[model samples]
Target: MKCLLVSDSHGSETELSEVIERHRGEVDAVFHCGDSELSNDSSILEGVHTVQGNVDKPGEFPEDTAETVKGVRVYVTHGHLYNIKMTHIPLSYRAEETQARMACFGHSHHPTAFEDQGILFVNPGSVMQPRTRPEQTYAIASFDESGGAEIRFYERESAEEVTDLYASFPAGTQ
Candidate 1:
């Protein structure tokens, strides 16, 4: 299964729509890690599983959520509550508690893909404002039947893969 993960669009509805359209049939699900700044009625988030970021108003969105995709349990959050910029320990613990194989978040606007213990942690960066790199980015996580996963980061508008920012891990480890 393939899932598209994006974050921090901060109200660029056009770009968000484009990304969703571009991967419409290519991926099984679309996850927005938050800070979209768009209201719940916005069409841009029609089919996206999204969390609320610190910038978002409360009551309309959930702070975090969990889902199972292709037999992999995934935890999705905006990361401010976990102090993600300083450390992933808190988020990792939450993922483990939920029995999630992967965790997706955004807050620092930095793109990262790494494994801790047996769980995978991914931050697709900010589509509107990036900090770790110049290019605005998102991530595509693909899981195969053989119990393996590959995560690839891509430039949002151009849809070009950021080859150097990729990570892979075997399945059944988390």
Candidate 2:
């Protein structure tokens, strides 16, 4: 299945709607890593799974979530819960505890995609912050039952990419 990962869109429904409408048939699911500042209304999210971010007010999510997607054990979180900016050591430890194949998070407002410990770690960056790079970005990860993972980084609003980096892992590693 193909999933779109976005974050730190503090109420850009235009981009949200455009992305959903544009990727209508391309991806199976859209995951928003919060800081959305939007309510739980279906219209804004239309076809996405969203979690709360630091600025996302109250009652969005407790902390983290673990789920199985396309036969891959996936974990999603905002990363602020564990003070991740200073280091990934703690984050890696938490991921190990979850037994997840891929972990997704946002908070650094920087796009990253890589494999570590046989798992994929992705950060979709901030859709509204002053990023270190020129393009405000988001991520898309496609995975099959065979555990092959493909990652694409897209520039916000442009619908294109600043880079195209891909990687995959063997199945049953997590």
Query: By TM-score, who's the top model here?
Result: 1
Count of steric clashes across candidates, in order? 1, 0
lDDT of 1 by residue, 1-174 (tens): 899999999989899899888997899899999999999888888888999999987866899999998787899999999999899999999999988888999999999899888888999998889986999999999989876899999999789999999888987665
Clashing pairs in 1: 147-171
Runs in model 1 deviating more than 4 A are: 172-174
TM-scores for all candidates? Answer: 0.96, 0.87
Q: What tens-digit string does per-residue lDDT give for candidate 2 at 71-174?
A: 76777788887676776667777777999877888888878877788778888887777366767788788887677787888877888866653445556664
Clashes of 1: 1
Clashes of 2: 0
lDDT of 1: 0.91
